[model samples]
Target: MAALSLALTALLAGAPGAGADEPADAAARGPRLYVPDPNPDALRQVVDLVKAGQYRDAAGVAAMVATPQAVWFGDQTPAQVEKLTRDVVKDADRSDATPVFALYNIPGRDCSNYSAGGAANTAEYRAWIDAVARGIGSRDAMVVLEPDALALLPADCGQDDAEGTRTAARYVEVNYAVDTLEPLRGTRVYLDTGHPGWHAVSSIVPRLIKGGVGRASGFYTNASNYQTDDANSWYGKLISSCIAYVEGGGDAADCPSQSVPRAEAQAWLDAHVHVPPSRMAHFVTDSSRNGQGPWTPPAGKYTDPQDWCNPPDRGLGARPTLRTGDPLQDARLWIKTPGESDGLCLRGTEGPEDPERGYLDPKAGDWFPQQALELVRYANPPVL
Candidate 1:
């Protein structure tokens, strides 16, 4: 523990002090996770409410979004990215916190969906990644690399990579990133392993392997989705078990799945695999909008569920923390940056607005006021 503290101190060198009134013993507790300066739009809403004498409401929203969160780096120029990265690391160091960064610029990101747009080609992506790495330098940073890079491949989305060239390039891009970023001494890289609701343990294990999970720190689940912590943890364990099984010369097809009964699955692991916790890959889950678990659309309400996208009444999940007790679980993170929109979700309806909400939603990555308030109001653990 002392060694870890010292490493953290080294990483936070040149960082500013937390505050003049901070307790002297605070440093003994190690670094807190850095929350990037709040979004301007959210802050403006707070200001507007305060001006209108809506103190309680303003306070509630402030409390919900003011906590430590990630800084996303996507589609910016190399120089812009470098400056932003260094600035964040410097700020976190000053505040005695550890910074988390999300890298989302793959060649064919999101398969031209709502959040579509990436580098023009593989070579450009490599250069962009190189710039990010240089900006990070030797700082102690945690990176959630390229969300959906693996789960939504070009081939699977009916992209014109018929010869598998684009799909092949996607793998190469992720592998290159793992190779480049994993070597940094104080850096930990986690590949995206889509949410448990989308990919079965057996299915994603192979994709994770192909995308270089073996070389990465581990994988992350439920980014920008609303799956409960219990469900996400169970799903992660199954994936880790499957990976260990395959690495030990067992077939991935034989692994227990999330659909299996819990006791039955545990029984299979107990009877078949002897691998210990340390042998399995560690994972993190997005707890930002899962406080109430997943939303259940009125039965048969729509032709397609689209449950993961901007569902109504979802609350905030677990608070951001590094002290998750499970040995194989590293942390519970707000990887989705709550209050950001999941695109104008049509949910398979023939209209410009969401059928459930009866209104148009914000575009992807835009600040969402109504949804943001709902997250705070229904927050399972309570925002306060």
Candidate 2:
């Protein structure tokens, strides 16, 4: 089949009412975002921490350091989630904040891999999507439809779990999300477009297209992963250009000068690399743990350099928030949601797991109070 990335470019470019002259005020208001990664488990911890009066300790820190609004689901059940989503959307509308959504749970998602496991199958995935859509109500909210769901699919992870027909099932699931969510009165749903380091523009665009980007609001470039806002903007622009090109009738098969070869593509990408603040349109980013990027283990010890495997000394990225200055940019989002574990933590994941830290203690998605302390450390002190 044509590469998944190409399909993404085409699919994502075809959202309903795109390029439809949004009001200037909309830009001024920017996209409303729900952040710090939207997992139910992590959000619950945040609530617990907040209730304990550790506002500076957890989600309270997120609220203080990032955007005031936090997205919450009513419950995991379809009926409850549906009601909760609408209520949250209404709350966002009333409070003048954006309701961000993770919309997790796709069958075989994470393919029983790290952050491993989710919904039983496609039908269940669809139900969850429907509930999320219903929850959106008729208010303006920004939804990060699904994280890593499209970007880190079967092929990307080396798992033949969803190849061919199964992959097609994923496409169906994603398209369902786009069709169901984007139509919400004032909602703009952005599909996950992994980070700049993970997939080439040509490769990822098709994946977005196939996953039904054409029907959603737009495809977001970086979510939860760190690659600097500067990097995110340039990457988003390049990818956006590719999608726009395809939507205008460009063939997905054509390499477009950049993707002809890996070396050439890398060179082209390098020259174009920059995180200008201008490119954040329908795109959103995860500012949670990116205050510092992927933690790199000291070289030579671990055989491999996949810092994304979970590294030490890595602090939070830009604080998760729903505000940003760029008119074209949607919102500076906390897509990853701070305090959630990145993976089953390790003292750096290679070899024997560290006993003191255990298998999942230091994972990226965990709620680390020390990490929050680091975030506050780096930023200019509060004026008050």
Candidate 3:
């Protein structure tokens, strides 16, 4: 999972270019979805669709698309990185869209795996952050600051690394990212909080707090993992509520309970699902390939749940965007680029390539070319 950190560079594919400013009130502006552009073919396809007046279709595709790119470990020179960002932003400007930014290069990125790469050290990482923040070029943006960096800190998969210094370093790195990007004109940065399925409310809340969730727009869930919208919503709400309760002087353990019967939980979740866009501020979702929702393994599939490893028949989920009905919920985004390999399942490395037969192509970022082409054909036949 740490391998995901390598995507920071790929994720920063866009900075600023053009777009109408959102209304002062985000709600009045309606639900604004973001589409990150890294793959040119996919970007052009969506742009063409939007240009053709297919807003809903475009939303369906771009809403939860993730363009989080490779940064820390790869050999992305300044010029190359800038070009990628410019290209993505250029396309976004033409499409009148804002790309969701996923900043995942925390110090111990991927814990020394193939994706285990960064700016040589903390100081270098900070400088890289500065360039990344600047590359955003003062444009309209929604950012997810570091994926598993916080979730997997001292507790999760992270190494204690040097008498616990690594743990402290992670915090500093996150704060720096928040501090750097928060001041940008219209950027909203959400720190990482492992999906509800991954961490208990108490467990995540503390980590988020340390990771600067309080200062950030909010914390994010379900990056590169398969959690249903219902699940994600409840997880996010519970975490948000827990944060609110703790901040308001409630006991950490007494925040709330989501372990009632499934029916009861769903009922409670339904009643509280729409917290209004204002309350949420802004949250993002990975609509890359969750349409059919998460994948479930058949009998005798594997020893461990195959959720982490790629499964089958999963379609793209809700589109990613800033518009959420619940006042508390901010933006819904595709922080995880779809189609990008979720790492070689066995080796734990996510490549930028796509698989021919699967939920989404691992190579094409998040654009489902096959699916998109089908829509294009349905909407407009070849002009013979």
lDDT of each: 0.82, 0.58, 0.57
Candidate ordering by TM-score (highest first): 1, 2, 3
**Per-residue CA lDDT of candidate 1, range 64-160, in tens?**
6666667898989888898899888888888767787989999778888888888999999999888889988888888999999999888888884
Ranked by lDDT, the better of candidates 1 and 3 is: 1
TM-score, every prediction: 0.91, 0.72, 0.69
lDDT of 2 by residue, 7-29 (tens): 32332233111111223366654
lDDT tens digits, residues 148-240, model 3? Answer: 788777434646865787788778888888888888887778877767567777677777777777777887778777677777777777777
TM-score of 3: 0.69
TM-score of 1: 0.91
RMSD vs true structure, all candidates: 7.2, 11.7, 9.6
Q: lDDT at 130 for candidate 1?
A: 89
RMSD of candidate 1 to the truth, in angstroms, is 7.2
Model 3 scores worst on lDDT over the 10 consecutive residues at 375-384
